[model samples]
Target: MTNSAANDDGELSLRWSGRVSLTPRILAVNIFALALLAGGFFYLDSYRSRIVDSRVAQASSEARLIAEALRSVEPDRRDALMLRLAGDTGARLRLYDETGKLLADTRALGLRNMVLRDPDKQGRGQAAARFLDAMIDTVVGAARPPLYRERADGFAWPDVRTARSGNLIAATVWRAPDRTPVITAAAAVAGQGVVMTTANATDITQTVRVERFRLSVVLLIVSLVSILLSLFLARTIVRPLRRLARAAVRVRLGRAREVVVPRLPSRRDEIGMLARALSDMSLGLRARIDATEAFAADVTHEMKNPLASLRSAVESLSMVKDPDLQTRLLGIVRDDVHRLDRLITDISEASRLDAQLSRAKFEPVDVGTMIAGLLAQREARGVERGIRLRYDHREGERMTVMAEGARLERVFENLVDNAVSFSPDGGVISISATREQEMLRIRVEDEGPGVPEEAREQVFSRFQSLRPEAEEFGKHSGLGLAIARTIVEGHQGDISVESREDRVRGARFVVRLPLADRQ
Candidate 1:
């Protein structure tokens, strides 16, 4: 089940690894939104229809006024009146008898106020206007009106026929040659003649074109601004992220030592925080790698000495036949084997200590009480080589720290054991716990040859021991101080060794831990 799940995850990762990134996706989202807004803007078909309806209504009103005047005026003066009204209204007026026969026409009588324009004779501007008109029609799905044409027989117009059939007024809208609206209206003339008015409504097209032009300009400007802002966002965000990603890739590809992660110290945002974190992580990983390499080399060198001694002792056992010599060789072999075993055990503990400490949960421990307990345990077991154990602290003072109890005890145990190894017979091993400001300071001092100032730092390093000459070989591994330091640091505390403060011939190991908050 796990293998199948892993395979599926690997496939998904390969599918979408590098196909699209942040910049293009951001631009696409912004442009898609703008396009939706543009769709709403360019839909002007309904507006044009409203304008055409208004023009037809206006034309019908003018026709009704002319019809009433023709009925009220003298028959001999009707042509002059029709021509004058046509000129005033900017439309052609035609009079027809009840039988659909044309009686009098405004244009025939000499008024030519309006004319239909030929699209072929117009300039490039008009052509572009027509192109835009067609585009708008297609986009908005406008239904085209029938084309307008003149007829000598007045009955050919539906509105004229309706007027002749006793209707008070009727109107129709048609498209002119240049795709502009042509509005016509007819009205009954005193129940005898029919009066028709026709206007080339070019102003409708110009008004729509003007409105479309303004909206187009607005859309263009908005689109430009949106694209520019998207690019700026990409630069501010994606560019830095890309640089960080590339640096991480370099680190992953074994170029960690050469790659310098950007900290972006100038930025005070989340990106800056992430950059600093990643940079610190990379530096810490590099330091860990170096420490591991040095540790491995030290372990190899330490193990070789014991193994070489064991092999020599084993070889000498076979070469000598005398019982006494053989007995000495067997003892040497045992000592070397014990040394090797002790070295391996300490090495394993040292290597796994960091991982264990990282996962440990800490609790408040009283430094004075814990040391007193340790001292009591030592007294129960009897001090080694008659060395004395002493613990001192303020009787009522609380010296508490947050730490893993067992690991913390191990640190003090190593310190006391180290002091015992160095102390002379019947010497004192003094342990003290005291509260110092925010820290719980514990010190273990021994009356022995003091550590040199130059060697104090090296003594805490793994496999770097300063054992007393009188101590038996293979009795102590040098990892005690190193392991104690590791546990101290893991608890957010520190441990160091120095000469005793009172000019005494002994080493003082001081451990400081931040005091836990008061409950």
Candidate 2:
């Protein structure tokens, strides 16, 4: 999946921007709707165009057929042919010569036995006499743009001249004066000149208006549905976000208050992950705040003990005059000073231990090799004390782990040094490491008094030292065990102590670290 600004790992400040939104107004104000509207208009116009074209084409074909029939008549009796043709066709028929001379006009009836033009349209459709004749003529000749001429009329339309040139021409005009569409078709005859016919179209404007209204209604309904769907989508997107936003606001305003973050665990989207992150951050911040406060209090309490001792030593020295007493009091002062120094040093290192571990890069290091090196250093000091630091493992064997080798060695040093202080003179400290299951367990066993069952865990606490009776006071900081525990836990390991299983009286400090798995 692609990462987004909305992802959980993104900064909370960016996620809380006022301008960011889950609104889907983009869909409601649609571009596709505009496209569909334009398409509908174009479709209607195209349909209108097709209707007009078909009417014109039909008119042209019928005109050509009439012209062919007219060619069967003699030129002088072409007037009779035109009249006969007019009786059969439902159109306004007219005949014109190549020179634009009117040959016959079917607008009126013939004279009493003489065939002629009738401008009054009184004798129309009179052949084979009946009451239906006048009705047929009136309906057929309803549109007469030619008869209502301005007398200076020019038939300059391309179809007229085109027909006169011996070719058939069909033309349609929309919205003629009589409120009807008109189609005109003209064709040239072989000997009887050109025949022209005109027809008023059946009412299609009303039909088109009805269809346009229905289409508009359909489009309106579709647009409304689209808007409602977009609204639902917007609600779906914004509901969870609204809850999260409210929780964040509460948490921000009331910094110390516990805010319950909205958790949508079913949703595997960015929003759900962000909710989880916020919850974790809240809990972590509270915990760190509490821990730092406790640490500070503990540090102050530890430092006060040495300061009180130093003050006592100085006061006692000023009151004493004997050299032996003076020297002893001075030693006390010196020891207290050294104790303060050790406390400060250990405290400084312990305080920064977390940050140091965070920043330090880990590399592959053999735990066995590290323990061997540490023992070698301690062995020299042990030799002077008539004690021995021995490795129980086989030579050259290794247990590898991913760690900052220096820090890991410091962990071993603390345990071994503690063992040294508590061991009797000439005591042997046995150190060995072995892989157990998926973990590496290292034990440092010393011939010293084993920790009591009651204080076993507390021995790892700050300033909880249980030193050997023979060791000099204030020579070592009590922070050693605490610091070692901190470092081991930072490496996701555990450190604990118990009586040595192989011996009845000795103490065994066991350090269990996770082993690095190889691919």
Candidate 3:
């Protein structure tokens, strides 16, 4: 018993072991898609970073400019300047005394809050003096001033502080009457306490938002276009491969005598190069097949004449020998003749099928009628062998298909003969026909010991057969199923075997052919 073929996993396993699968192509497409996605994300990230940096720089520079403007105001005009600056910029202004007490607040002064003063006078004075000395040293190549002073801290001081002669002075600055909050900028004044200005950050933030929105829209459009183009490219690359895959399958099934792939214009690119390579490979394969067929035909023709002469000589020897010896010699001759006949027949059929396939005529024939006729013919042969033949047409009458009638009939005869040969005496052989969508199916089943699970597939290969258990039951030529499969495929159909147990209990051979629409 041999193991039968099984595809219970719902995966398409390639039968031709030498060919590579398309998994790598699929992986490459996915990889390219991921690259596109990553590129889009990277572009957006870089754009957002630039927008953030620009916003931050603008904010910092605006703060510095406001602080500088406030520092140049005169002490007498400081109050007026603060009011004007606060009103113009929509910001708050505050002055503190050296003691960390609030000295003045633009908004609070209106509410009579004792002109806010600072309490940390000594700390502010020391910090101011140090900063001034650093600035002088940087500008003049020498420290030109030291300003620090600790005072009884009731005086109002500006929010900005500066150094003068080892003292940090404190002074009252103007206040503004405004309800809107603002971003404040401060600078230390040299002799005066501090100068501060305020400006609205709202406009800057709004501008940033507008710029971000515009950039986002542009980025989104570009990303979308990029994705679409990537999809187009993926499809472009995959389409030719898909066609090549189908052509490969046809070649594997022995359906195609020659494969002619269409030229690709896009072959100037990498995918185009791949397509050209595949086309070249297909042409080479066709040429090799042609050469092999010619070789087989020449060899078979050369051997046939010698084989015929050998058989004739053996027959002559049998006629001149003793009865018992003659019988033995005749048996040997018969075996040789049968062997030669089978060899020549298989080689001839293989070569002819290979040659005629490219030009075989195809037309519509009723599948149900064809099966009925085959069953009728088989029934006549079965009756002589004490076997009963049964047939069932499950599909309604006149299931039509587009195929060559003679080739299809040969396929049918081969399957029926295979079933009949395996069927036991008093056993039944059944024929069935059905249609499903675009295909017509025919099945022949024999009640015998079913083929083993493993042997079912090998049974369809040339010269492959089960080993004979009893010495008397000679092994079959084994090319019947292979030839039948070839014929069925030439008609654009498929043939496969189904069996249950390891023993030859029963075997069902199924044939599927494309249905043709009736006018």
Candidate 4:
């Protein structure tokens, strides 16, 4: 059950993935990764917070220093000191009583150090900055600080209340009406009231926005490059594969002769390998189909001869009155029947030979031993008219090859039988096996007519015959050498016939197979 479910899940994933073509999938994955990187860059939110914290610390220190100065100064001199400190620090300085009553301000002292502006009263640029700040904050999920506002009671300020009650400095950061940070700090004077400092840190927002803008530019450039590379990759891989697929479909639809599968010869990648392999496969399949058609036509031609002979003999038997002629006609009828049977049997074997050899398991076959054994059997059954078979090989030498033993034996059997059919009665049919470099060579020589140079190759084709003039018609099916050649080639070997090298007036059939690895 678990395996089945896993298989189902795997198939479902394949189906889902197949819905989206390769180019889009590649683009989507790259864009998603870029989005993640952009999200990480947006961490400028924490960067802004750190900048505000630093400003708050500076404000707190300034408040403490101003409170100490106010404590030592006389009442009238304190206002001038506050005004000077506010002008130098670029912060508004204020003094409040312990009872939360407002006392003195930097503006009241004619310093006019800092002013908090309302965003609604600013220009379009400020509005755009505020909008960008909100977007950045939302993207990074930054904490939202309360808006900065003035209160009638100074003690109502959180930092101010804390400073007065605890007799210690307290700082707080607030968002201004323009979305910039406002840092405020309050310090309690020992013998006096509270000292407060406020500053607007606009540089923090500017810094974060600049970083985000730079990141956006980088992301845009990378996305464009990634998309182009994806398209290039898809063109190199997907286009060739699609061409191969369309060719295959055409081939499957019986248009193989017309389809030309592309062979990407210039590329050295796996896709190139696939294209070449498909091209080769299509060529091989097309050849096989053509051969099958030709073979069917040949089979029809071969069978029709015997069938027509049989039909004529049967029809003539009824019209003839003489016993001798009737007996001759009956003999002709029998011959035709036997000939047809033999032809059918040979045709079936030839048709199935390739398929069988493909599935055949091979073992080490000693060519010398196999040939000797075959000759021994033929000799035991005595050749007609004192005909003799001769075997030649080194007694103790190994001539092993990798092959299906039975099929290899059949190849030799056919060769020997073919030689016997051409050899004169009482003549020696020479058989020899020898090692030739990395191959095992066997030759069957007959003392009779030799095959013509031009007809040598044709003799191995299906239903081709080059029989002796003395041999009766239909004595041989003519598929022996053809089947033998097929079997030999299946074992990674070759077969050919030529005039005997010894200057004899006969033909020599040579079979060469790769020698088996001894180690």
Number of the top candidate by TM-score? 4
For candidate 2, write residues 271-316 as lDDT tens digits. Answer: 7798788777767766776777777888898888889889998988
Answer with 1 or 4, whichever has the higher lDDT.
1
After superposing candidate 1 on the true structure, give the runs of residues whose Cα lies further than 4 Å from its correct spot: 1-19, 165-167, 363-368, 394-401, 436-438
Best-fitting candidate, scored by lDDT:
1
- TM match of model 4 to true structure: 0.93
10 residues in a row with least lDDT, candidate 4: 9-18
Candidate 1 versus truth, CA RMSD in Å, comes to 3.7
Candidates 2 and 3, the one with greater lDDT: 2
User: Which lDDT values do the candidates have, in the order given?
Assistant: 0.89, 0.73, 0.59, 0.88
Write the number of the candidate with greater TM-score, choosing between 2 and 3: 2
TM-score of 1: 0.88
Once superposed on the true structure, which residue ranges of model 3 sit more than 4 Å away at CA? 1-280, 283-321, 381-384, 394-396, 467-476, 500-504
RMSD of each: 3.7, 10.7, 18.3, 3.1
* Clash tally, candidates in order: 0, 1, 43, 0
lDDT of 1 by residue, 358-385 (tens): 8788988887888888899989989888
Ranking, TM-score, top scorer first: 4, 1, 2, 3
